[model samples]
Target: MGAASLVALLRYSDWHSWLGYMQQPYLWRVVRFSLWQALLSSGISLLIAIPVASCLIHRSFYGRAALLQLFSVSMVVPTIVAILGLVVVYGRSGWLYQLFDIHIPLYGLVGILLAHVFFNMPLAVRLLLQGYDLIPSGQWRQASQLGFSRWTAFRWIEWHYLKKVLPGAFVLIFMLCFSSFAVVLSLGGGPKFSTLEVAIYQALRFDFDLNKASFLALLQVSICTLFAVVVYRIAPVNRQDVSLLAVKRYSLKDSFWAKSADALALLVAFILVIPPFLAIFDPVFSPIFLLTLQSAALWKAVLVSLQIAFPAALVSLLLGVSFCVLARFCMARRYLALLPNKIEHLGNLILMVPGLVIATGLFLFLRDLGWGFQSSYWIVVWVNAVMALPFVLRALMPVMYQQERRFRAVYLSLGVRSWSRWCLEWPLIRLSVAQALGYALLLSLGDMGVIALFGSQGLVSLPLYLFQLIGAYRLEEGACVAVVLILLCLLLFYGSTRFIGGRSLVKH
Candidate 1:
């Protein structure tokens, strides 16, 4: 079938003519620009996050706990909300540009990088900090007692721990940037700087070039699948310990550098964290923001978002539960679950598929079906579900494992039927379910991809509507909507995690 498709592609069909454009120097230029920007952005975010994470882990200061919580909150804010703030702050009319009188623009590759960093830096901090948590407190004190310098202590103690988690972290960040669609779409000033996902969107949505879209989608899938497999192979094995230690505390010595590092981490964390939150609030007092409270369209968009998000979250939970069960009970088929006894690979695989690729492929399949439901609401729901499944799986996997181990003898002695057992086991798994559903809802709420394709004049999710507001230069309304979106996502996340992670995860 691929051979036939290749022949058809080479036959100079009208739609396939765009294949020549793919090989054109200008297309490669866009590809080169995207690659460089993603690499630069990911590298810079990791560099900044690593030291700050180290400081957060290695020392204690006033408000240290508060700072960590602040960072965690930043990690959950939607990309649209964060990037909207970046635009308002760094764009031509923004406070910084006007204050500095700099004519430079933050609307192209530079804008994309800043937005990516703003969205991703907190993730790096959290993951690396978690890595730091894995290391015993004694290791650091031992190195200090041995008279090791800061560099020596980090090189000997922290470096090994960092190494254990670094590959997974790097891969996670890379996949995020690689598949990054919303930021690139919003910040990319024109077609000059675009990722594969954006390119696929242009092809499918604007040009209606299905052949070209299919080819691009295939290319993306092949590249991402191979990259995921390679990263999974090299990822450190079973590096995360199941046991949680007593929270270790540290007091920074009264040295100039120690003081400097803490201050630096605090400053960086604050700068990265604060503006988006305030930007959202700033719009609330505007006339348009006030008017939006009475607008039927605003309420409609909210209802649409809720409808998509709820079903998507439910689907994600169901899929995640099935996956968890298959991995747990079907021991021999466990290898079919991707990485055995490890959470990283399965999560990475789900994360690696660029949102655009999945949306494009499904669009084509539906188009070929010539069905009436192609542009219906269900497509958005399914795409959101798929996008969210990985996160759901990640949240539930550990909880499922712990529950299984905790109740193994009890279940075995009772000869619990696999499907019926869940009736009795649901309470133990409820927290995990909550966490999974919470993440799924957030994912769906923030999604702008599939809906962008299938969305019509009559159908718009909140993210798509916000994009339109930005396109139409309704910044204040966009900001207000952004605030509303963030709040809803936070509520879902908080409620779910509060239950899922309560005594079970904490007791560990």
Candidate 2:
């Protein structure tokens, strides 16, 4: 798909025209804004995440475990839903605004930064916490025995693990922010604040400037590809560590300043989490919220969303499995010495391709092929599957490699067929498989970019429906849909994790 899109761009666009378009001041502004905001968002998220993760590591507060789990909710929450929730807290008529009689615009760069931090900061915290959890307990004992100060412990011990973990986390968050579309669309206010992804959408969808859109899409792809290469070079390879039985930590010396800082960090984390839940739950008891439940359009959208999500998730899982299997097989047979690296590069490339770019490419390709918007349902499924591919691979590859390492010789010696080999391995990797499926499902459920582009009046998914409701100034209905969407995604994720196998191996 990526190659086809690039070919289409090159076939139609002249080099001189593309270079001229690239030289425009407005184009530079878009590029500048995109890169600048992404850098700031990633940096700010990591800065906040370190202290929050550290506090969580050292403190045993009530709801700490639940709070950690809540961090995962950001992953599944639709961007529009999250933006709406943020508006409810920070917009002109929001709770904060009403209480303080202050207007904090939930649009432009401010909104973008706020939205990015809300989504990515929790992810950073989770990754950092995982890193902290992997630290050997004896290391903490050693630091304590040496009478290390808080600063000494953090600098000598905590920073050591974080140095390895933070770069990857930063890169992941930066890429996510770079690819942001729904948030930029809903909150950017105008083109002045637009990112490259949003600019691509505008060029194609609104201006009908296919040539310009193609050039911009190619530029976006090239920039993302460069970032992916850099990330692959810099990020440390992940190794599966046996779960730590217990994480030991030296008790902090009692101090007022320390307690206040921890309290403040927890408060900020809670602030990040509260608005989304509030946006969902607080509207449930409203009179119009129940009325939305009876709307036929709501039910239709739910059915359409389910139809798209399930197949997309399955397709993504299949593609990820096929990639892992092919890579493993090639490596085993020495068929292609660079197959593993190529496969890894492909996965990273997919991770960097924004959904908007994929949707734009498919839309153009299908239009050229005479498959009109009538085939949008299938197009949506295909794009969602592709977008979900990276997550599926990330979740499954490590386990697959581990299984192959441990079982390949045994299976070969016994002359095990492919089917029997899979059966033997299924029990061991089922949990990871379930995770991959759930990740894909949740991603498809929350996706807005592709559907926003491809959805017709006759075929509206829940995200599209919710977006329409918000656009039509039906906040009550939008809120109701947002709540239902959140519940549906969470239910699907939990069900996939719990019942996909008789015994679930997911620990956290």
Candidate 3:
């Protein structure tokens, strides 16, 4: 589908037209802003995550476990939902502004930065915390026995893991922020602050400029692909390792300043994460909650959201499993030695390609091939499945590889073929499969990228409906929708994890 879209784009757009669009100063501004905001967001997220992760690592406070779970929730919260939460805290009529008579401009670059940090910081913290958690208990004991200073401990022990993981985390966050569409569209205030993703939307939906949209899509692919290549070179492929069972810790100074810093870090993290939880209450108390329940459109949107999410997630899981199986088989056979690496590269490439770019490419390709607008439902499903591929692969590949290595010899010796092999592996891999499906479902449920382009009155998913409610100045109804959407996401995520052996799958 991606290849077909690119082919159509090249076929439909002329080199001269692409050159003309590229030469425009505003186009360059869009590129510049995309890179600038992504850089800042990634940098800020990492900077703040380090201390917060350290605090989480060292301190054993009440509610610490619940706080970590909240971080997990933050990682999967929908982008639009998170943006609404930010507005409740920082908008013109928001609590902070109205109470303090202070304005922080929730509709421009500042808002963009704040939103990106809110969404990505938890992810960074979680990733970095995992890196911290993986340190050998013996190493921690040695460091403590040696009375290593904080800086010395960091330099010798902590820095090694951070240095290995941080680049990948930064690249992941940067790609997310760079390709962002819904967040920028809702909060950017106008085109003066637009990114390339928004520009493609404007060109296709409003301007009806296919040439311009195709050119911008090509540009987006080029930049993102470059970043993907760099990440491939720098970030090591993640592997699951058997580790010592004992919990380990490196004692901190416990001095006044150190305690104060840890307290401050926790405080900052609380402030950053609390608004979304609080925002859920707004619609519950508001009269709009009843109205939203009574409204048929709300139910229709919910049904539509489920319709898209289930199929997309199922397809994503199947593809992820197939890829893992194929890669494992190729590795075992030693046939096509580069095939597994290429497949890995393909997953990275898909990660870099924004949903908007794929939507644009597919839209152009479909239209050129005489598929009408009605094909958008399928398009949304296909693009969303592809978008979910990387996550599914990430969650399943490690487990699949581990299972293959552990069982291959046994299966061969026992002659466990076909149905027998399936029976043997099902118990081990079911949780990973469920995890991938759940993650994919959450992603599809919250997506606003391709849906923003293809959605119509006839086909309204929950995110699209929520966006509509916001656009139509129905703030109360929008709040209600936001609450419902968030709850549904949490319910799906929690249910899937629970059904798939609960915390075991979640940890994986």
Candidate 4:
């Protein structure tokens, strides 16, 4: 992953053209719009997420469990599929128009912001809600005994919790929105709204301007790398519990007005998050659904998607395990302590230079080498695996590191070695491992970035196939494919987490 990405970015140097490209007005627009949208998206998501998480934490509601689950779902919905749903609801001719004579003009920055908030706000809420679990019950008891009003309780208690988690969540969401591709590509409308990622794609794919694409890819990498360094310097106030299910929280009593406010927040979040999913699935009742489902091409795409997903997941786990093992080894020793963190940051290099940029860089490199279409499949697989590495490592590292720190000496003295050691360890690490594998698989399966560059007659994954269906103006077929993709992702994620992880995972 490191070699290919770095080599492709650097090997074919055209510094003079790159300098000229930097001066282009189009380049500045892409850079300015990319940063602006990411900033807006992150700021807006955090503001909304705080109140929603507060509602979930303080107010007991009838459908709270289901609503929390739906928030998690928003995080996993394929980007393109989600955009399709957003378009169906917000486009000039969509549900809003037909039902209420309202049009959102979802072809530019407005649509991009809506799509980003839909995906990210719920995620931000989930992360924020977890922060409350880290707060001791004693604090809540203290507030109760002090006869603290809701405002006072929030100031002393909830704000403290939010302060701890908010920065990390904002950084995560900002990186996501900044490096966003599909949302901007599908909803950006045209050049006026294009981001760096979209501009890179257009330069390489349509304009055939290799110099411009390479320059843009390098520029994108530079900006992300700067942010990654800054993020590393700012240590997180707390380590969040990564859980798939809704967290169980201790209840807080609210006054009628407070309860009303919480209810209003929940209602807004529901209206924002749920409608697109419902809109996308509405095609299930259409007459053409069966026709779309029965096509051999559709099945072939599914098979291809699975083939890519499995191998990519395995490879991700292998790399992640290697990094964790090395980090654990480093942490166990005194002198090599800093190396462990530095090693982890190396895995994060992929985040700075995203899969799309890498794909373009390699596409440029491979074209120079005269490689044919057959290479695209393996390239996609490799990139997907690498792309998934950071996620896999996040899931595995803390659990593995904690186990080693606590148990290594005990095991050594007891002569608990090899198979026995694994037996002792499996139950402790299995859930984390299973979740990591599931997430990696889901990411690869739903990925549109790598596949977009490499997709051909022989290289169609499900996302690529769905993109083609939409491109041909086949909305019914596109929705069918989208539905299948969503079902496949959800079922696979559930199966991996439930069966492999041994039970439904609940954190506090």
All candidates' TM-scores? 0.83, 0.88, 0.89, 0.88
lDDT of 2 by residue, 1-508 (tens): 6666556555556677887896799999998899899999999999989988888877787887667657766755678778878888888888888788878778899989999998889878867875775577888888878877566778888887887778767777888898788989999999898998888778767886767877887777778778767876886654434434345577744456667878998898788777656866678888887888899999999999899999999999999999989877865676575676578558656656666666666766777889877778887898899888877876677667767766668778999868888888888778778878988898898888888877887879999999998989988889889888888888887788788744544333
Report, for every candidate in turn, its global Cα lDDT versus the true structure.
0.69, 0.79, 0.80, 0.79
What value of lDDT does candidate 4 attain over all alpha carbons?
Answer: 0.79
Candidate 1 per-residue lDDT, tens place, 1-508, comes to: 2222333333333554657867778667756775677678778888888888877766656777656545555654567777888767777787567788765467788888887777678778866765675666676566656776556667777778887767666767777787788888888888787888788778777887767766665566566667667865886753444443344543323467766876787687676667656666677777776787777887888888899988988887887777777667643354454434443356456555555555555544555668555456776787778777766765676557655655667887888876777788776667657756777887788778777877786678888888888889887778888877877877777776676546444311
Q: What digit string (tens of lDDT, one per residue) describes model 3 on residues 384-496?
A: 99988877875676567666666777887988776677778777777767767877998899999888888998779999999888889998889889999988988987787
Instruction: Give me the displacement of residue 29 in model 2, in angstroms.
Output: 0.7
Best model per lDDT: 3
lDDT of 4 by residue, 1-508 (tens): 5447656766665777677777788779888999999999999988888888887777666878778757756775788889888988888788899999998879898999999999899878877865776566667777777777677788988887778777666767787888888898888888899888887777767776766666777788789778766765675545333331233334455588787777788888987898898888888898888998889999999999999999999999999988988887787688997787677768866776667667766666777789756578878888889988876875676677667766878887998865797789998888888878887888899899889987888779899999998899987899989999988988888788778888655441
Better of 1 and 3 by TM-score: 3
